[model samples]
Target: MKKTGLFFGTFNPIHIGHLIIANHMAEFSDLDHVWFVVTPKSPFKAKQTLLGDHHRYQMVLEATQEYPKLEPCDIEFKLPQPNYTIDTLTHLQERYGDSRQFALIMGEDNLNGFHKWKNYEAILEYYQLYVYPRISGQKIAEALKDHPKIHRVAAPVMEISSTFIRREHKAGKNIRPLLPESVWRYMDEMNFYR
Candidate 1:
């Protein structure tokens, strides 16, 4: 069977922190490729301030181009907006046939609200979940203990966020250090989020 991990994120703009997490997952997990599922819109988040989906997707492309392990995926964009993970998983499974197995990669912070996801139980039943520490490893493990397919990993946490970077950009501050050099250059060249 082919092993693949889907690192789903809004990726408002792919940054170094996101890259680090993806790299860690690639190194530690049995994933052949880590696909960055660039979400068009997240149902849980406030959408007024969100960047355009295509711009964010392009930034992800630039950021992950050098890393063979990372592939920027727009499958979610093709799916329904405010899309449910379970529905996306179902679609992907059918599209790939029975030969491939995909694991959902997430952070511990997502654990609290995971139950709120549509058809959450079915998602756990079919796809294996690889969770990175967002709060604490023990908490993650405890919360996901009921799911046999869930694996909590101790990925290095980089205290960086796209929100912080966006704030800096709006304030006319340098955001180069917060993002991958390629993303920074692309953002600058395109004059985005200013």
Candidate 2:
């Protein structure tokens, strides 16, 4: 089975930080490919500058075009709103079958609250989780901190966030450096966050 990493996010605007993490997983980790699963909606977040689903997916496609191991996935777009990880994983298994082994790529901060996710226990029981370091004040959950299925990857700590970029651009600040050149130019041409 080919090992794959599923990096889920709304990707309101895919940035360089997102690219670094995904590419690192594809090249440095056990994953053969890293798929950026563009989420339609996040149950945890309020949609502030949430662009259309297709637009965000398009941005991901443009940003990842150069990377052969990185792919943009819109799996959750066809699923119901308020999509959950467990459900998506189940769906992916059904669609891709046993030929692919899928894992979740997450930030260290999210590990702190992983237990709160719906069917999180089932998720851990069934799939591996590739955790990347993040600059967070929270501690990882005791149960998850030492789970056998969790693999902590020593990827770069990316402090950049889409929210910050959007806020700065809206304030007339140049936030182009924080994004991939293709993504930055696309956002600029679209007049997004302005």
Candidate 3:
């Protein structure tokens, strides 16, 4: 069975940082493949700043076309909203069955606040967590530092963010280098963030 890592993000416009991180997970970690799970907007939230769900998914699809071990997943679109990680993980495992073992891909920054997530303990009990480095001031939880289920991956610390790219593009600056060529072309053609 192949180990599949689930990288969850809105990916308003999937960028090179996301691509590099996902690639690193697939190649450097125990995970054989990494799926960019494009998280949909929550219905309860009043803000609609995010791009359409399909638009973000398309960006992820275009960004990952060159990578054999990476792909885009829109499973959450059909699932009930206000979804939790545990729910998503359970659904993924059930959907794929025994053919693929699923794990969560996260950054060190998220580790500090992980205990607060819904059913955090259940998630740890059922699945492994592959955490990549991030430039953050907060420290990871003391008890989780040596947890057997959490694997720290030596991936690059990517400072780039989709928010930064959006701001720069809206300012008429060239942020093309931060994104994959296909993603950039698609965003440009759609007049996104401008």
Please provide, for model 1 over 1-194, each residue's C-alpha lDDT reduced to its tens digit, 9 standing for 90 to 100.
87778988788777898999998988887787888988887888887777788988888898888889888889888887788888788888998858778889988778767888899888888888888877454354354666678887789977788888888897999888889888888888888779
> How does each model score on TM-score?
0.92, 0.98, 0.96
Q: lDDT (CA) for every model shown?
A: 0.84, 0.93, 0.90
TM-score of 2: 0.98
lDDT of 2 at 27: 94
Ranking by lDDT: 2, 3, 1
Residue pairs with backbone overlap in model 1: none
Where model 3 places Cα greater than 4 Å from the true spot, the runs are 42-47
Better of 1 and 3 by lDDT: 3
Choose 1 or 2, whichever is better by lDDT: 2
Q: Candidate 3 lDDT, tens digit per residue, 1-194?
A: 99999999889878999999999999987899999998896433433778999899999999998999999999998888876778888899898967999999999998888888889999999999999999988978888999999999999999999889999899999999999999999998999999
